[model samples]
Target: MSLDAEFERVSMPLENPFTISRGTQTAAENVVVRVTDEAGMTGVGGAAPSSHYGETADTVEAVMPDLLDAVERVGDPHALHAIESELRAVVEGNPAARCAVSIAVHDLAAKRLGVPLHRLWGLDPSDAPKTSFTIGLDDTDRVREKAADAVEAGHSVLKIKLGTVRDRELVDAVREAAPDARLRVDANEAWTPKEAVRKAEWLADRDVEFVEQPVPAENPEGLRYVYERSELPVAADESCVTAADVPAIADRCDIANLKLMKTGGLLEARRAIAAARAHGLEVMCGCMVESNASIAAAAQLAPLLDYADLDGSLLLAEDPYAGINLSDGEIRLAEQDRAGTGARPAEE
Candidate 1:
């Protein structure tokens, strides 16, 4: 079957400036991809490249032609393994770019089969976990307000961004606002091992479920140190990028946080999850600030995740696409009766 591919860049304003330990962003720059077969069936996906990962919209755009060319050259949507392998050979470091093509191809393949992406994989959507709504770093009061707002809006799980000196105060504020919300914290590799341990003590008391990337990915030993002593479970985000990295982090963290943008494709993401599970690590599927064009594809993996932080689309001021239903933070994949990843232009 002949295939045609194309892409465009989109800049989505955030409802609020999203801040992590490293920095803040008021807008998310994404590259959206579409792969269409000769029959006119189309699949949608997006790349929200992170500068922290040495990729930007410019970089994603720079690499798209080659990535999409690889897709067209494969000439078959269901030839996922071949297409993904070729994508890697074409571009070594543009994980986000490759991921966009990957998601698009997967979407198209599933669509051609007239099934949801998860069903294509034989996953039971009922097994999917509820996703966490993130409260980005802000003033303690604003954080508390956001937490309250989230709770009022029916979010039962919340992930808070922490790394400042007043981390405890921020947690305290969130707990005050969302006392019943299942809480998780992401330091984005901002803490020292000792500081992470110390903070974990209070975070544990505050009933935080876990701490994510408290220390930098560069310090594996330090991560091990905190993993051994910290009061809360530690999840490795920065340290765990691929299946290969899972073995290295197996002894360092309790959970392996995998992102589609980081792994470069759906197939690589599954490999990472399997590798993490084989190493006795719980898996969490996370995402960059993305639209449904990609987040919908990520949602297809929810059934396989122990934890999910796929709230990327929730942070956007407006999205031009719609895929899955995350109402009240429930990844309602079973309720979405659409084919493919359920990603379609918003107007649809």
Candidate 2:
């Protein structure tokens, strides 16, 4: 069976400025790829580029044409492992670009089999966990407002962005605003080991679930230091990207946060999950600020995770695709009748 491929760049405006320790962004640059077979069934995927990960829209766009060509040559979308291997051979780095092609192929294969990607992987949607909504770094008042809005929108768990000078104040305000909400914080590699330990103690008093990437990714020793002293569990986001990083940081952090863009695609993410579990670390599936195409693909693997932060698409002002549904913070998979990743272009 012959296959055709196409890709285009998309810019999605964020509902609010997404501020992390690195910087702030009002919009996300994504590359969306689609693969269609002779039968005209199309499977779509998207890449949300992050400069922190050494990926950007221009970089992803630059590599996709050749990557898509390679995908076309492979012909059989069901051969996901071969397709991913072929893509890896064509380029080094550009995990986001490779993720687009890999997911598109998996989407196509799952659609061809007339099943959702999760079921294709022998996963049960009933086992999927609730996802957390994120409140980016902002002033205390705005933080309170966002927390309230998230709660009103049915989010029971809130992931707050820390690392600001007013980290304590921000959490205080958010806590007051949503007293019953479960809180988690991501420092985005902004704190030192000492600061992380101090902050973790403070956060634990306020019921924060965990502290993520409290220290820099390059400082495994620092992370270990913080983890040993932290009153709360420490989850490694930046430090644990692919499966290989898992073993090294397994003893340092309590949990490993896996994102598709970081792992390259669902296939590798599965390996990352297994690797984390093998090391006796909990797994959390995460995503960059992305459209539903990528979020939907990630949602298919939610059952394998101990936690979910798959609200990247929910933070967008206008998402082009529609896939997963969230209700009171719980992620609901598409009906079993729905195929592929259970995502499709939103009706214009």
Q: Which candidate is the best by lDDT?
A: 1
Which portions of model 1 miss their true places by more than 4 Å?
none
Off by over 4 Å in 2: 334-337
Q: Give candidate 1's whole-model lDDT.
A: 0.95
TM-score per prediction, in order, is 0.99, 0.98
- For TM-score, the strongest prediction is 1
lDDT of 2 at 324: 74
lDDT of each: 0.95, 0.91
Clash list (residue pairs), candidate 2? none
Candidate 2 scores a C-alpha RMSD against the true structure in Å of 1.0
TM-score of 1: 0.99
**Counted clashes in each candidate structure:** 0, 0
**Residues 251-331 of candidate 1: C-alpha lDDT, one tens digit per residue:** 999999999999999999999999998999999999999999999999999999999999999999999998799958999
